[model samples]
Target chain A: MNAPATATAQRKTQAMHKNLQAGICFWSFLMPALAGLVLFMAIPMVWGFLLSLSHAQNTIHPGHFIGARNYTDLLTDPEFLNSLWTILVFTLFIVPATFAFSLWLALAVHSIPKGKAFFRTVFFIPTAVSYAAASLIARMSFFSGTASGFANHLVGLFGMQPVQWIGTASPPWYWLVLVSVRLWLQVGFYMIIFLAALQEIPRSLYEAAALDGATGGWTVLRFITLPQLRNASVSILLLNLIAAFQAFDEFYNILGGSGSSGGNIGLARPPLVYIYNVALSSQDFGRGAAGGFIITALIVLFTLVQGRLLGFGSKEGR
Target chain B: MATPMLTTPVTRRQMLKTFVFAGGALLSGCARSDYIDGKLVLTQWYHQYGEKGTFQAVHRYAREYTRVNPHIIVKVVWIPGDYGTKLATALLTPDGPDVFESTLTQAMVEAGQTAPLNDLFTSQDLADFNPRDIALNSVNGKIYGVKMIDDLGLLYYRKSMLQSAGMQPPATLDELMTLAAKLTTPQRKGLFLGNDGGITAMLNVLPWSAGADFLVNSQIVFNTPRTVLAYQKLQQLNQGGSLLMGAASDWWDPSAFTSGQAAMQWCGMWAYPAIARAVGSDLGAVIWPPLDAQGVPVTFLGGWTAMVNANRPHVEEAKKFLQWQWIQNRAIQTDWCVGYGFHVPPRLSLARTTPKLQQPVPAYAVNMLGKYGKATPPLWNAAMGSDLTNAVTNIVKLGQPAAQQVAAAADMCNRELQRELE
Candidate 1:
């Protein structure tokens, strides 16, 4: 009986030692990434929140605490409100447009049996281009206000006079330039995502649908293909929505002044650009930080609502 | 068989020792090689100027500084884009430059970003520098920056275009509009304020030309009938189908004017060399015409100023560097102003003595600048400027009511001013 009891005690000690080893292994794997997240992301977020509450002008450090004044000020300010409206309009335009175009490209590419890789690479090439470079191309070459611009040249061929594509705000023709540039830059990325999802849809579904007397083009697409792509479609919509709200590079490069002292055109100023101007250009860090948080909350609220409606991450979504 | 060497289990102490050795090696490899035994290292920052040779000029100045003071080394950092925003961000950090060049704003002074340079200049030195530049850099009886160069903005028109059109250079806003209309042709538009129309350069020009001051004794004063009338006239000009809308370049560049896309361009003195090279004898410079009889012709005085960072550890050394580079060293100042591009020296004495200023085109520009040039008020901060710029855009492009827009802008400016005062 004594020998048996001693053996049980030895087994228990070995089990405890194995558990200790496992814990150390887990922590060793996790510590670097965890430290990075805490240092770079978590610390800045908390510091930014505190900065939003203070009157930090021309400085990033928190100054006198004026609770909620910056928030109230931004909420009431017409320019800030207008920026919100501008971003909403941008979202309304960009999200559905990118989704539809990307989906269309994905379907087109998937149906092609020959040179599939070629077409896919061709469509995906724009994804590699930087937004700033693309914006410059769009502004200086394609949609320039000059008569020699590509768009103006095309219009001139039709016997229409050259229209000032970017300079005039009365007709807001700049939206066409802004939308097209963003679409060109982003559509390829979303198309690749959709292509991956399209491959995941089993070949058996199309066969099964056809066996059930479903027609080839419209019926098969509507019933099997559409349902299969729901997860990807929802994801792309959310991503596009968030990206639209964060629009800065194209608008800034195309419409903003050339140098540091240059100002962006007020017509299509989105929220991020407005906040940047407030914080960096105006040197009002408190207002800028407050605006940043407001925008963050807005993005979060939008993402949640969108997720709920689309059932994102749900078992049904999968 | 014994355990393979590769399969051996390492103890925690051995692992820590390995990490320690690796860290020491990595750190030693990363150590800076530029360090000397007792030399003080100074960093100076400059915004990239668009003209050719400016980069080389600034680097040469840094090399020269080291030669003058053997114990000190000056590192010149040429910031390429978005300079103001980058400088503002850098100024908040501990490793910011010891000396930098920028326009002095009230917010910078309020944040204690720039050191007062009263001791760097003698009374004679103060008198020699342009008074307008001194006023622009002063706040609360303290001078915070020494002007490095003075850039004067004016109208550049093609003499041949105007002569062929049988028109003199416009003497009034009305005449300017009429001349623009007369010069418009099938191939070219008449004027180019900027690529985005007239919002960038004309922001201050319109107000000052209309006999309206942005501020008077810290009171908002731009919201007046004259200013509204000026906007109305500018709106009319923009709508007249004569002002060049889409150009290859903005107004700051002489490309549109020299390329004959526009007959008249609103630009600065820096464009003189390029315009001379392109248009030769056809280039003519004039002040922006007054709005009405009650107003005055306007040219804006804009340039870079050298300031020592107050928060840096080498504040005294930085101040001395600025003094040596911009103040005491007249030869370097002249080279910096005239060698790369055409700019008026901030020192009046230099401007008078420089042979380049006596040239016909540059002398005319100097004369016009002396008569009508106005520096932006230090109190007219970026936020206030944005409000006015928005007002201008709305009135000119969108056809909004000028009076209402100016009034709204005034309200916003008042609020910003109140914050500054607090």
Candidate 2:
């Protein structure tokens, strides 16, 4: 602080030298991680981009370089468009419902006076169980088209009609089955995150609000709780969004080709399922790869859009 | 694959000095033709059959095959899910299986994945097998694999239900509807048609039976009054109120028929085992309902055939196995079928003459066996089974009209056919 301007100017070069020296000091520690990121993530990102632009996969055969044709076809294709709407509707249905349920559960557990940990664990056991297993069980529970499954048994107990949960419109019932299983298996993990975020807010803010007149519902939520939860909500939103897009394994297992006589309840044919149908079922790798790349792009774009809207990855958040 | 790990990654300078040492080691290993080692292996992949007895065949053949050849060992893999993709992928690699089994198809034969057996077997010998079974293996007069079995889809039913209703199995779409209506009630719906390729498959088969070819010169002529009749009747059978409950009913086990939940089921002969297992005694199968005026029953008969891999190290040895499968294979067929319990031998001679198919399942299903038998309709892939199933399911589940759905579905079939064939 006592150094003169001319001396400060001279010392700045030495300061720059020190910054370089510090970076060099950390070089060995950071090099492997950096190299890994480049070799795996960065390289694959470019490769996927290249694949998205082309129409070939898993073979040496040359593919058409119809730059954005795949994307355009995806945008225009009726089935693809229907799937987009289906996914968008699914995200809308599941995301808010899941967020609301998880948040409610989290707040309930947060407010629980005794044995909150046990309650949390109990609530999360379904989450810990693989969604595939849960969905299979869930499918059985709903499979009471003729007084066989739990749903029909329960309905019969109450003198109510047995309903077909998955035997509806093609695209609709499929997603309906998917979202139900998805939300059941997912809401708990999000609840835990929200609960942790809820706990992170200082008690002083609440106490101050109580002391003042800002204890109204909206005031407390807007001023204190939401402000506190800004980070967790963004993270959960991004995670859930990406998960919704990349959802394959559960759907693949549940609504697979191995149904009772390979029936019409083909619910799992999401983008990945469709891709599998194309590549494996029809032996059209180019088409499947195109679908995969489209899904990946949708995921990335949706993630970024959600992040940008939530002020995530921004300087202010940091 | 394991030997590469034995060598160290040395610098080029060091490698120049150690070249002789590495070369000497490679030469020694290469020269070792250790005949006594139990390492000469043949790999085969098959879909899991009853209690995996088909898998047991691999071990049984290995041990018993010693009477013929003592130097061979076999490894069998029950390809987990979607055998088509796994087989196709494996065939592409240089280190693929030595022998495998798959349903032969003209397109698949054309796809070049199936190895042509024209050099091995004479045409006259192959023609002796059922034409339908051979149709799958033949592409441009070249055979790709041996016909392992002859399977035909038939309607398995509770004879008691049809008797109680005072109606026999119908021969046309009209009689089926009347019978379906008679059997329908809130407590017990008539049948489980299921949503598989049957929706489209029936269209292909019945039309052929009715003298309506679904396609001519590669263009679809699938739509017709009889086809529409099939569609309408399909709708009526699937209608919500009295008959079929909903699309989900399709997935209820066909064994439910013996349990008496479903009065009837349309399924493959493969289901006989499960039905036999479920029922205390042998079950029954009727020919696909509503036979044509001449009483001709049509169905899709198909099966998987054993194939020798082109890249197999023991291709010649594998061919010997294939040849052995045909040599007095009738007894092996009966043994395998009876041993598996649910299966009847695919050979016409064995199925008819042997007591297995004729052993009085309840007035002798073997009587119905020939009556029910029909060639498999040409199919590109089995997924059509699911897609058509979905279409019918969609009609029932979504409350869409059955005839229109059938029409749209026939159109979809045409599209998919064009998609594949082109």
Q: Report the number of the highest-TM-score candidate.
A: 1
Quote the positional error of residue B161 for candidate 2 in Å: 2.9
lDDT of 1: 0.86
Alpha-carbon deviation at B5 in model 2, angstroms: 22
Best by lDDT: 1
Worst 10 residues of 1 chain B by lDDT: B30-39
- Model 1 per-residue lDDT tens digits across residues A75-190: 97777888899899889878999999999999999999899999999999998999999988888889877778899999999998888888676688888989998999899999
How much lDDT does each candidate structure score?
A: 0.86, 0.61
lDDT per residue (tens digit) for residues B129-226 in model 1: 98989999999989999999999887888888889999999988999999999998866888888876687777778878999878878899889998
Question: What is candidate 2's lDDT per residue for B61-154, written digit by digit as tens?
Answer: 6566555666766666777556777786776666677778876644455445556666665555554555545665666666778766655566
The DockQ of each candidate is 0.58, 0.24
DockQ of candidate 2, scored on C-alphas against the true complex (2 decimals): 0.24
Calculate each model's fnat, 2 decimals. Answer: 0.54, 0.31
Question: Comparing only chain A of model 1 with the true chain A, what is the TM-score?
Answer: 0.91
Against the hidden reference, what TM-scores do the models get?
0.94, 0.80
